[model samples]
Target chain A: MNLVGSFFGSSIGRKIIMALTGVILIGFVVGHLVGNLQIFQHPDHINGYAQFLHQLGPLLWVARIGLIAAALLHIWAATVLTLENKRARGGDYGFKHTIQATFASRAMRWTGVIVLAFLVYHLAHFTLGVVQTETFKETAPLNHYVMQNDYRVAGFTVVKAGTDVANVHSMVILGFQHKVVALFYIVAVGLLSLHLLHGFNSLFQSLGLRNAKWSWLLHKAALALCVVYFLGNLAIPGAVLAGKLRPQTAKVAATAQR
Target chain B: MTLRVWRQAGPKALGQFKDYAAKDLNSNMSFLEMLDVVNDELTLKGEVPIAFAHDCREGICGTCSLTINGKPHGPGKGIATCQTYMRSFHDGDIIVVEPFRAAAFPLIKDLVVDRTSFDKIMQAGGFITARAGSAPEANAAPVPKGVSDLAMDAAQCIGCGACVAACKNASAMLFVSAKVGHLGLLPQGQAERDRRVLAMVHTMDEEGFGNCTNQYECSAACPKTISHDFIARMNRDYLGATLRSAFQPEAASSDGGGA
Candidate 1:
């Protein structure tokens, strides 16, 4: 193996790669959450935000390619490490007892798989505008909604700004109105949070950045972050289900779909 | 007391738990001594006594190993099997005994395993050079007290395989890293520091031991309570050494060998 290949081929080296890629994905998750939370603002804010991203064009694809690479590498490292771990353990001990390993630590592989599955569905639902076609803002005959500057007036297609854009603000609210979709999102994000619970802390140890001194802080911080991320994700679907969140102009689009 | 011992005739033989009555045991006797009493009776009866390993019987040697009731060294912290007294177990308690299990440390008999895989890792790390002349003054190579203490902590590893037995993945990273850290901390260990960490880790992976997941089970099972910090230290050193060797090929060879 060449020097670079040899470096990444070893056990520790594989883990180092996993940690690096994990950090990239983690950054994306946080950034994605921040963008999604703008749903609570005026319809114009989030719609304009979506419009701005659409304008990024090629840059967005570059970011997407980087993210896809990170996810693939992360899965690759995890598979190699998990299989090696199973083989090294060999036969089962007659009596097995776990002392200090947490449930989150042991559940990494299972949780990761679930999160990846969720990512696929999430992309289908929002990015491709394929799943839940009825609620997709960019769907035919009901795609355009005028952006209104007013926050509380409820953005309508006949509003003051009159600039046509995909109604991303209502699409999110309308999609979550489906109980199954909302529950699935909640469950999937919950598993992703569990995956992050162990992963966020483990990334530090894999990179040798964590020792006894900062271990406690990193552990607590990772837990807090996972909980916060999970709750923030949960709140959106939860609010829509509870009728606290409503589409500013989905009535017209919903009737037009019928 | 009833002893549920894992009995295997040989490496290829199938193993099973065979119960033996260990009667009239004194709580004051160590776990090994109780086993001795049982073995004496078995020898008199013309039966094969339980096969196990022991040496100094002191915790320092790391020679004695057993998984007493699923925990290495039997339900105590920072002490080996030899140090576990019968007082810890109540009368008539069923104590289960088994050997340390791992792909690398293949079973030798009922309770003994081949741990020479550790020796292979040590050989890969190699030895530090020391002059054969009269003892140099301690001040000649001044090592900070804290640094020396840390080295001693890593040096406390007795090459015991309990860490492997305790780890869920059967990883030997803690053991390998201990050897790397103990020497790498001192001035004497610097010349081969890069090569040592790199080769030792390479050998460790080749040995079929699992990778560390930072669970710290090895540290918890360690008789000497060696910190898991050594693993992290070794990781940092390994990364730096790999990068340095690639960038400065000349330094890698002069230091002893290319990683």
Candidate 2:
């Protein structure tokens, strides 16, 4: 493995991993954003959506694990390849720069790290319920609630209801409602967009599909997708904070035994 | 007029740019011809003249390599330094000349870096491995004219380090692509096509050349105006070869060393 390590670390190797894995991750990101966008449709729609994912049983967990593994592999390879790239130039100066490449291609490593940080914070605040502060506030008021011949404290807010003890929806709302946190989300999404723009173009280059005519157009498509995802995700928190969004209400139904 | 030129005593020695004043130089002389005049004066004074590389004074051979006034092969498209005329510069112009400064092309003396990695890449490409039999009639191998023309066009790459020098990342993709395409164009070179691309690209990485981010400086600085389109072709070939190798899982790896 050590002997042939150089062969695997070449530009060609980097391109192969980048292209094959890039398409997979892009598909996942698009689907994930679309799924996340379900919040605007109806209030209880998100809960039902979450329930559908939960009902997948072991397959849901399998998908989660697979995503994490793929993300890690992609990041790891990118970091190694970037380091190798830096080491190749023996500290020299030149007046003329390569004019064909774009800024996104240049800042891929930095943007990638920022996106990784966003992912970790996102998972922690929403999935782990580590920081359940004053953000997840109750909007609906009720004097008392009766359920199954028993009285219980009830609020519009969702608690940690999943198998993982995570109140993801509440966390998302709380995090976005804060002005500073919302700003961070906006910036992070911007950086992510930049990363994706270059990444999408370079993905084609790595795949050896550098057709001059259509390559730029592909870059545009990638940029548009990134913007759509960013804006779509950003709108949820922005609307929630603006008081335009409220907790979804469920209608009571008569049971057969009633 | 004095020109400040980068002079490296040897590979492992500390080097600096030295200025030499030529009191009188012919305005009609070629840039390199002026250098010869300087060398003659230095020899008369029992001093070592500045060393650089040049062969065919014509523009065809890419041997006369230099970064003149910060441009590879002395500022212009489709030309080497040897082909550049002194008329391009004013008599008092302070010219700063230096050899190619790439780790992959370490300086052996004053202005010559060891560009043998190029030759090694060509060797790995198996460019000279075909059987020496009777020449097949040109019509028998009537490749599509477009492919044949493009292949012939790419075959014009002279193994010069200008592309590496001009690249900000010091990528050697342009040079390697030319080699990969030279063989990949014809049917005779088809047998080892997969192996050739894989080997040459691997050697490029091992030699510490940077990745091709599709920065077209290599093409711009090329004396032959070698199109970056060839790079795209090389990349496609490399990916196809790698995928084929993966599916077949054969012992198809080649054992060759660098230039």
Candidate 3:
């Protein structure tokens, strides 16, 4: 076998793959959360941000493909390793007891499966526009232009034409406006938090980065990161359900008029 | 006291727990000695005695392995089954004992498992290929105190396979790590260190041992109190060895043109 193939076939090699893919996925999730948080900003800011991404065109496709590949590799490695672990256990013990393993560590596989299922639902709901929420509304592309002039002069502001917006801001707000959809997202993100809680430290260990000197710090960092992700993600749905976020129709109309 | 023990007549026989009552067990008796007392009674009654493996009765031999009440070597830290005393248990408590369970170590009968797979792993590379010569002076090749201490710590593994019994994954990474770290830290073991780690790890995988999930259960269950740090050390060594071997051909070819 080729060197790469042989390395990947080994247990440590597979673990390394899981770690690398996990890092990539974590980056993507963090980036996604950041962009989603823009819902709290002005409508023009988020819609323009979406337009900026849409203008990236091919670069956007590259990122999408890379994320899909990383997700697949992560799931593949996890399934294979979990199966191997199960087989190694031979049979059930008469009476089993856990000594040091945490609840998050024990629930890793189940949380991973839940997060994966949520990923599919999330993509279908927002990205594919397939699983429409109760508050779903079809939005048309709007031409965006910058009117940069002295704010003191109301009508004398200069309008510069820009690219069209995809109305992603409206989609996010309306999607989360549905109580059931928002509740589902809250639950899924909670599972994702659990998965990340155990996975970050596990990733370090799998990649041989864990040692007695750094294990304590690494575990604390992992827990902190999980909490950040959980709270950040949970905030969006919480904001939407509480009627704190609203569609930026007035701003969009003003931009169109300008 | 009520004793619940696993009973399997043969390698393929169905296993089950059989209960036996002990009337006069001294609290000062070690757990294995209590088992021996129970066996003596059974033999006197013309019944097949409980079959368990033990030698030296001390903790060093690694021969006496049992999962007592769902714990490897019973409920204590840094002590084997032979070191556990009946005093640790309440008088009316029911003590459950079973063989160490793992796909790699199959049950032979009762609490005895065929741990010869560990022997196979050891044979693969667990030794230094040294020349038989007169013993050299102790200080001829002095090792740093920290390195020697680490080596000694790793070398304490008795290969009892308690780590496998305690692990949810039944991973033997701790055992392989101890073997690899013990030798790799010594000067005499340097010549074949790379090959030793590669061969030992390959054999461990082939023996149907699971992958390490960094759960630390193996270290917790270890009779010798071996640390999980050795596993990480071995992981780093394995990566280095694999990469070095991968680039060895280019390195060899480049060496010919150097001079």
Candidate 4:
């Protein structure tokens, strides 16, 4: 069999697919968290950053395509492996017990499915501006007000104004201001983190990297990183809900009232 | 002591737990010894004895298979079913005994399953092909101590299906990895190391075994207490072997030294 055919045809090879794509997906998650962290900065900073991403044009599309492909392959491999595992076991034991498997390890597929759903809703809410249509900050009165903010890039002498940029800062703030939306984001990312708890360490074993000397550190690192990642995800929505974060338009309106 | 033992007339027969209570028991007796006494009473009443598989009554020979109270090879650490003694439990305790479960090891009778699947996997490439006639000089190879120790650890696998019985996925990766790692780590094993992993793993899949999810349950249940590191080693070997095979001819020279 060819590389593709061989990988897809066997049990171990399919798992290799999962580990390989898992690496890509993990990289994307870390990069995404770092980017989204900018929401804590001045509204103009996040808005300008969104504008800069748009300016990437085809490069952004390339990344999107790669991420989408990785996601698809990861899910596909997981589905195939799950079915094979079930079938391979044949009959259920009268009394089954878990020894070393963590609750997080057992619940990987459930969390993964929900995370995928959250990803879709998130993209619609933020990327496509389709969900929560009224809250979409790309149009109307909210966009006009927020556009008054100007972004100052760190190294540049001149300010890059947000006059033409969409108010991503306000959009995120408004969306998360709704208690339900903020809570859902927290819960979704919570599950994603739980999924990563097992997945992060498991990838090494799948790729044949785990060994006696490194196993302890790998497990500890997986636990630590997953916690940090979830906290980073929790912070944005948490801050928005707490009123620490406000759109530029809201900030401007508050200043005018004074 | 009271025992809740699984009883099935045949492979296709519906099996259920049948209670056997023996007031005259010895805590010093091995788990199988207690069963032997129970069988004696059953024979007096013309009742068919509870069926189980055993050999060597040892911790080493992996033939003795049972899941006692939901644990493979009973509760004792690093021991087989035959090594599990009745002393592990209190007198009058009702021990739940059942056959090792896996699709690959089909139930043949009450507690016996056809474990020939393991045999088939091992037959694929578990042995090194070197010489048939005489023992070679030990000094000629001069194997490294660390490498030999690692090989010895992998070689300790007793072809037991306890790992499969214990895994949520029923994965045979532990066994296959041990088999692969044992030979692959040695000089004699390198000649067919790549082919060994590929063939054994392929046969394992063909026999309807699952993939390892790194749960470490297999190692936990392993009678030998084999480390899970061998699975990762085998995974590396298998990946390298697959990529190499993809690039080269199927029947590449086995010399490993050939460029």
Among all candidates shown, the one with the greatest DockQ: 4
Question: Which 10 residues in a row give candidate 1 chain A its minimum summed lDDT?
Answer: A150-159
RMSD of each: 3.7, 7.8, 4.8, 3.3
| TM-scores of chain A in all candidate models | 0.91, 0.75, 0.86, 0.91
DockQ for each candidate?
0.69, 0.30, 0.58, 0.74
C-alpha local distance difference test of each model: 0.87, 0.71, 0.83, 0.86
Model 2, range B170-224, lDDT digits (tens) per residue? 8899999888887798887798898899889888988888877655778888888
lDDT of 4 by residue, B123-169 (tens): 99999988898888889987899999999998999998999999888
Of the two candidates 3 and 4, the one with more favorable lDDT, higher being better, is 4
Mind giving the per-residue lDDT tens digits that candidate 3 earns over B1-259?
8999999999899999999997689999999899999999999999989998889788999999999999899998999999999988998899889999999999999999989989999999999888789898889888999999999999999999999989999899899999999999999889999888888988888899888877788999999999998887888788888888777766555767766
Proportion of true inter-chain contacts also present in candidate 2: 0.50
For residues B1-259, could you state the per-residue lDDT of candidate 1 as single tens digits?
9999999999999999999999878988999999999999999999999999999888899989998888878888999999999999998789999899899899999999999999999999757867889988889899999999999999999988899998888999899889999999999999999989989989989999998987888898889889999998988888888788777745446867757
Give per-residue lDDT, candidate 2, residue A85: 58
**CA lDDT of B215 in candidate 2?**
54
Ten-residue stretch with the least lDDT total in model 2 chain A: A143-152
Candidate 3: clashing pairs of residues: none
TM-score, predicted candidate 2 vs. hidden true structure = 0.79
After superposing candidate 3 on the true structure, give the runs of residues whose Cα lies further than 4 Å from its correct spot: A133-162, A250-258, B250-259
| Shift of residue A35 alpha carbon in model 4, Å | 0.4
Cα misplacement distance, residue B178 of candidate 1 (Å): 0.9
Cα lDDT tens digits for candidate 4, A1-258: 567766888888988999999999999999889988998877667777777777779998999999999999999999888888998887777766787789999999899999999999999999887987666766553454333455545665233553666667777887887899899999999999999989999899998998989889998999999999999999999998888887666553343233
